[model samples]
Target chain A: MTNDASPNTQPTYYQEVERKGYSRRDFIGFVTMMTAFMGLEKSAIGQVAKALETKPRIPVIWLHFQECTCCSESFIRSSHPIVADILLDKISLDYSETLMAASGFQAEEAMKNTMTKYKGEYILCVEGSVPTGADGVYCMIGGKTSMQILEEAAAGAKAVIAWGSCASNGCVQSAKPNPTKATPIHKLLKANVPLIKVPGCPPIGEVMAGVIVHLVTFGKIPELDRVGRPKAFYSKRVHDSCYRRPFYDAGLFVETFDDENAKKGYCLYKVGCKGPSTYNACGVMKWNNGTSYPIQSGHPCIGCSEENYWDNGRLYERASAFAGFGIEANADTLGKVALAATGVAVAAHAVATNVRKKKLIFELEKEGKQSEQELKS
Target chain B: MANKYLHIHRLRRVYVWELPVRFYHWLNALVIIALIATGFYIANPLAIQSQHEASGQYTMGWIRYIHFAAAYLFFFNFLFRLYWGFVGNKYANWKQFLPISKKFFKEMWYVFRMDIMMLKGKEHMSIGHNAMAGFIYFLTFIAFLVQCLTGFGLYAPMSTWWLPKLFTWVPAVFGGDILTRQIHHWSMWFFILFAVIHVYLVFYHDYVEGRGEISSMGGGWKFIEEEVFERNHHQTPNPEN
Candidate 1:
């Protein structure tokens, strides 16, 4: 319960930026862009700038368990060099297994120092899911199970951030038949801290930066959607903001990779673009410095940001197929078979009903004729 | 035998279905047909390849609009039908749909034996839907709810409107978007199956029983033989059972 962040004692984010040799103009420009990214009105830019200038940097303990480290790679190698430098410095990131030069006991000591010094004040950013199988033997770091480490680190944190789809929703390892029993951070953490999930295979670098900045800027988690994702970034589906949306509306689509439609940049929906279902900021912000994304490069979105995306369907197939209706059966095939069977059964039933009716009528007519003849005789 | 002595000395026309009931039936049929066509198209859009600019053509957009519009109509129509079930006549009452009574099950078994098993028994007919048909329609209503839920669930993310937003939890329950879409697709097939068998049975019953089975839906009246009417009236004090 120690509040180590006495603003006078520790250097503010502004001072850190200045010490890191970034001009004041750069700091203000970054803050303005961040404010806009957070879906704030223009009036809030000054308020955010003032807060960051005086507020002490929040210490972050970034933990990695069963992950590819793509989230870490994306963060450090953000296309915008200033974002990488300032965000890296602004968080005062105390320990990251991937980025920190220290290893073994030294790295552990750095993490321990931050956890103890800023108890209940530092942010815990989990980059991967914790494998809980075999009492969490599947993923162990520094001779400690991910479950034990996550529980220990999360115990004294003020707030927790599940970094990528892996930490947020159990990305790849927790796909069907997950042997390690990989569980997302939200399910593993027993602490009652606020958890913000930034779910993507590797969420856009700027999005990751935006989430961290929003916390440090506002001193609270940004407004989240039903699934606990930041509403500003995850509110709209990629298809809603895509540049090629007109083509989708027009029913113009690329039939195949080598087709003329592909050259013309028609909508890639028919070729299995999942932009319509996947909620993320890729279409609006783009990737690689807002230059191009997967769709722009003539490839369809695999819905890496969505939960259970790996098991939804084939990466390049439409969402017509599902697991419930047999292994290879899809909507069309199943529907057609069902309709056909009904058609055949109805035809057969009609024939049987007609034959039965005809026999009954004939019998009744014969009986009536015989009765009339007997009465006349 | 009873057949030798059987005589239809009089045929009386009795009003069975009310105008509102007939209206709901026809409207539901049309709406379901439109929804299925538009739903399939949305799932896999036709590659019309408009020669004009994408901005000029709104083929997929118009189709989706029609689908959503029809969906709203379907929803409200269902609600109206549910309201009518409580307040409408005995033939149209919600009680007719539930197989709660022992006599209802007996009648269901008789209908199953005579119609499905093709047993040689006296023609079992009712002024409105038979026990078997009423039960099946009840199940279809459940499917209708599923269709509405999953349909609105998929549309929620695309819509800023509050109504569709309320159904956002549907996808999570079904696991994800693809599965929700799959369930919606499956419900369409159920309607198709129901439609096929329903039409066939209507035609078959019209020919066999000759009680105006097909025309009763359009005219809201059915011609019943006097003897058969008297027997049915005595048997069913509660017409629903």
Candidate 2:
């Protein structure tokens, strides 16, 4: 129905997936699922389907640098089996070091062709940080520095998407006294392209899909926060939608991993849940087809989405960074020490005042008696 | 000794602290203490293993409720003091807080030298707050306002109240919640430190000056020598006094 009206060279995402043996029914079901879970209206399913059926696939140049490649793993491990195929078809993914079968010359050639052909039209998806130390030799792919690769790739792109915490804000590599000096994408390359940060240790699989879907469907980046995270996903703290939030409000918390409270599904605040401070869709979107996230499995959020989360220290410490109790001593410890010191000072001062008062009273009595005797004399 | 001193000095009762000032002073003290207790709890709650449902306990909610309620009282009480400074007794005047006057600087220097530097026989005398104390209080007031802006700014996201919503721009102005919470939490310590010093200074002044300085806040009255009263009258003679 669409071949006559559509472009000749490129097949639509629907046609591409259909060629890969997926039924039109599977395509519509995927759209309907995306609409339901991606916080979109029922009408969005039709629009999403129409866009997939009609529009040409978006060209994506996925570049890897200094990362664990967990973002790529998470993206491919999306709950829906069809999402991978749909994603593969819809994104027209030119090159990814980890995902693609092509290697050596063919991989390099494909990336070069996409850069020259698509130029300003393709999306530049960055999955890791770039090490700027020693002329960016810390990370090299096929004898080319990540800095050079990123610059060449980012120089001609419509928008740059930082795929994970590593890409958005250098994960462990950029922690305190970073030897490699791995800097995030936004810092390394300063181009005239819109940048979106999907910042988690590895962002939720569907959220990645949602971002791509938003760009493909809307033809523009989704509404971004001040920090460039998509507002639709990063708008609320994980604690807001958490199941045990009522327990938090009520001050019931799991004292330890093996406690009765933990068994009872109490709030994980005391066990150092960073849910209140962390902004991510993990709670709402969940993981592995909404089966469970970290908190649901009784593990405290490590605040992997936040900048410098690794440097923040200890995922299981109770006090938030706001509480001033993460690294050394929490605020309670500091305040208790200060209060105890204040108490000791007050006690000491009281004793000193009492001693001084006793001396003054004694002298006053002695002077009074002496004055009385003198008056009598 | 009382008779002899009274006969020698012709001691007069000078009504320096007005009822409104005294009321505000004690209320502020009480509220600040309550805020500190609840604030620390809000920052980090005690691990009380109550044998009840989450809905039944409502412990953190109560702690937060007490915090927000006391914060409101502290805010309004501060506002009242600000208003009273404009139109209340001369001693409660905002002009006294500002060290703009040459006399203010002179008193501040004298107090600093005599009290802080432990200078003997420096002869520190003030029927009301000296410029040094007043200046510190002015700074404390500014800090209190910042606490309100930041506390409500953080609350704005959590609360449905229009009052807290008014301060929503504070985080945006200050960058975000991390800094705002730090400022808010740190200000509590400021008040605590101020309280300790304030109480100590009052006791110290009472002991050194041999005056009813401690009772002055409670009774709105201070006993001074007739000469000192006359000198003060000559300086700031309010008809009410």
Candidate 3:
């Protein structure tokens, strides 16, 4: 492998690719695949390929705070072999608490050394949220609060990437009545560095790699949505491109989790699937190398990619209703009100007609009585 | 004929609202009722039944058709009203809408004075619509314009060819489909509140002041002493010689 140890040595990422047993043809193929997955145009593939072949590997520091480390787990199990290897080795992943073999001060020393050596040049990847409620005592690693360590690391970083929903939006940790006051990385960091959020309970692995590749290749962050998510991935709702869209359109929904309707692969929307309102690429990208997403495995999406998936509602209860077109359950309230109003109008008209008829009959009877009285007189 | 002195208790036959204006008022009311009914249904479908039961039910489809058709009718009604504002009779013309002059200021003062005096049970009235009612009527017209614009803007995307481009500024001005839907939903509240207040004012004025305001919209004007009417109009009554 190309030794990136020397600060003066400019060994390109291509050298690392060659050392990893990937031929030129293999490197080109990886670039083509990345372009497709990243939703980049064919014209941009050459730029991506050239960057991979020439740009020096970027230095990255991955921090784990109050998290399950699922982001790391998902990253390593990416579909593309080169994605994991290239990101871990070629990208100079200097410090990760879960992946590093060092213990105690050794691990601490590695983190400090990287920050000092590559000051203002490294990327800071925060995996989870930092609790600030109680002077940041809720979560600690190696005698320092996760909040303290995060601020220290983020102080000299060029950019920050929140890897999961926990780090991006505080996830379950910051849901309603959050006791520990877990704050997202972006909110905790007061720096002017560019922040990119890849939010999901555990963001898709390929998406994680794609963010890094785009950063290295373009020398800038990808175009992001209003919420700082990459528009290329988070722009379309999961319902828009889901495989079970036909079932949703036909209104064939799964009433329960284990029902016959569910077994037939009908829409899980009625069973508390937040897919219709959530925007994520999971349905299209699929996890574990394009094998299957959560919905495909008979589990409705809990909308883990959204801001507060945990506190939004129950995972097993369908949304009451969404504000959109079509009759996707719970939209019949308006229909009922309309029908009731029509009935009331009809009843009102009927009463008015009856009253008019009674008035006419009474007048005729009074006229007859008056005529008889006049004749007798 | 009835006694001339007792004739003051009878109704008069003078045109005020005009046929075109009355037609506009009633048609708008009916269409708004239909729109709100179907709109609430389209917003959230509450009732559900088995496929067999739902199959025989054309309620949703028919409601949607009525709603959309009423929307088109409202559009044309508004168009005609706008045209008539410039070309209709003096009382129904564009001048009736503009309340920015010395005369309006004086009228506003008297209207406020009347409201203050009304606390002591002194009768306060006007031959035409009162200043506040005129202002509200103008506001209702503006509200109608907004409803038509937003409703059509939403409907355009469905047809996709011509109408969408015409009101493309709606989504851009409002933010997106989500925001537009919210505005359209909430706008219904304004119309509903206005309707309630309007009906209440009509009845309150008619019953309490004996103005026959409610019947004015149907058969036109109310009865008043000829001498008082002539004095208000700065005319000398020529008695039969």
Candidate 4:
């Protein structure tokens, strides 16, 4: 409902929130809350508050490709609806297929206006991978393939943000034998722009907010890992911060979903919880207003945040032996079989060897007796 | 001293495996078996129950501890063998592991035909490891090194020790802990295969040749025919050089 932010009356984040009926105290609370979510010290809250109150909001163009749109759902459902409202209202979000209410030509024109006005200055946020299979016929929007739209938009963006596992690592669509041949944003576009990957099945809403806050507050992307993920959220594995980690170190695990161990809140490692292998802030950040995550809800993490998770094998299977990569048996079963077969073969060989050696020994004794008798004669 | 049975003349015996080499061989065998067993339990732990507190029963924890301990033993023992190869007798020397000469290549070819192809069993005598066995052991050493790096790589994130921390970069290098773990698990199969073949061949040779092949590894001695011993004695001793 807010008017376009022109160069003259460009309001800061606080000014927009106040105009949207938020008190000054509410604005300060928001800044402090976001700072904590970003794993920053309390003192940084003042810095964030100052940044929001003084700096002009940046322009952002959100693009959707071949995806389920779960990322948008998660983003809008942050712990506080005000957080989502403030972020969207505070920024110059010119175009978003999921958020924009404008239809047809009007929406396209708005996106074109933003690209031309703020060329090489606005942020490009991509939510899914580009399906290059069949000339990317898999994902076409507004009579344009996702690939064409991405290159056109990315060409004038300052930095790109890969929103979720879909755009970051090609999620399920790029799994083995990928019919669509969906490629991730970074690989699909040769923009050579600095990419910040906020990867999760649907990333924690606060985390998405945190990245934006860091960029808006610092004028640069946060520190990233080798795979372009923020270190603050992905520095440690879920296992490291899991409430059941003590149970893991103690070797107590739930055998079955409804078993006694499961009732006792034991570790779900044996049941193929990908907590140990997956790197994400789910354990620390929690989901649904800091209420609970998948593990706490009696369900194992399917490693949705990780790359190629869909093709890694059955969700409930352990990483060590997931479908044995098509070998029906797991690593242990196959190893045991190999050992047993070798043992049987060794036994059979020993029996056959005994028979052959025994016959030769008897023949050698006969020859010795014959030679001795001949010598005596 | 009482009644003597008819006896045939057998050539004198010679020492091949030194005490240290024999010690390392059997120790390596024991450690490998332990590693394989413990490694299996660590990867696929049994569903152990504890009536009391979870801390009371450290079943999987102890299994992992045993695996790490055995892995360290295996690594150090291998290092010792490598050191011995440089200073020990000619048979255990480092040169034997390399195909540095024409004889080594010829011996390898002969073994490929005799053992693998089953074409012929023409005798090609060497007191120490045959060229093929030596080459295989060399490859096994490389596998051992890989196991050490990947194992510690997986352990690095869980431990505070400096040793494992040295390999902390390996998981990232391999893309993830799961892939590194799979590689570590697969290498165990290589050792398993090596052990089965190694034991079977020793038993087979001991039965067919009656040269005390199995006993030699235990007592550091082997028996050869008189003519064969004489020929080897009169021959030059430049095999190692």
lDDT of 1 by residue, A1-377 (tens): 11345424777788778888888898888888888778889999998899889888888889999999999887776655567776673446788887777899988888888888888888999999999999999989899999999999999898999999999999899998999999999887898999999998899888888888898888999899888899999988889999999999888999889988899999999998998888899998888778899998999998898887877777886855646888678777887888999889888888887786677665446655666876999
Residues B4-117 of candidate 2 have per-residue lDDT tens digits of 532334468878899999999999888888888888776667777888878887888888899888989988999999999999987898987888977777778777665665
- Which stretches of candidate 2 lie above 4 Å from their native place? A1-9, A89-91, A142-144, A320-328, A340-377, B1-7, B10-23, B79-109, B161-187, B219-225, B229-241
User: What residue runs in model 1 are displaced by over 4 Å at the alpha carbon?
Assistant: A1-8, A89-91, A324-327, A356-358, A361-377, B1-6, B234-241
User: Candidate 4 DockQ category?
Assistant: acceptable
Error of 1 at B232 (Å): 3.7
> In lDDT terms, how accurate is model 4?
0.80
**Residue A316, model 4: Cα distance from true site in angstroms:** 1.4
lDDT of 4 at A147: 91
The C-alpha TM-scores of every prediction are 0.92, 0.84, 0.66, 0.86
DockQ, every prediction: 0.50, 0.32, 0.09, 0.36
Which of the two, 3 or 4, has more DockQ?
4
Candidates in order have lDDT scores of: 0.84, 0.79, 0.72, 0.80
**Per-residue lDDT of model 2, residues A1-377, tens digit only:** 11122133567778787888888787887888777666788978889888888878777889999899999888887877667776753346878888777899888888888888777888999999999999999999988999999999999998899999999989888987899999999887767899999998899988888888888787899898777889889878888999988998999888889988899999998787888767789888999888999999989988888877765546777443433354567544566678778877766765665565555434445545666776999
lDDT string for model 1 (B117-164, tens) is 888777745667888888999999999999999999999988889999
Look at candidate 2 and tell me the lDDT of residue B124: 36
Candidate 2 lDDT score at position B65: 90
Ten-residue region with minimum lDDT total, candidate 2 chain B: B232-241
Best by DockQ: 1
Q: Sort by lDDT, best first: what order?
A: 1, 4, 2, 3
Candidate 1, A58: how far from true, in Å? Answer: 0.8
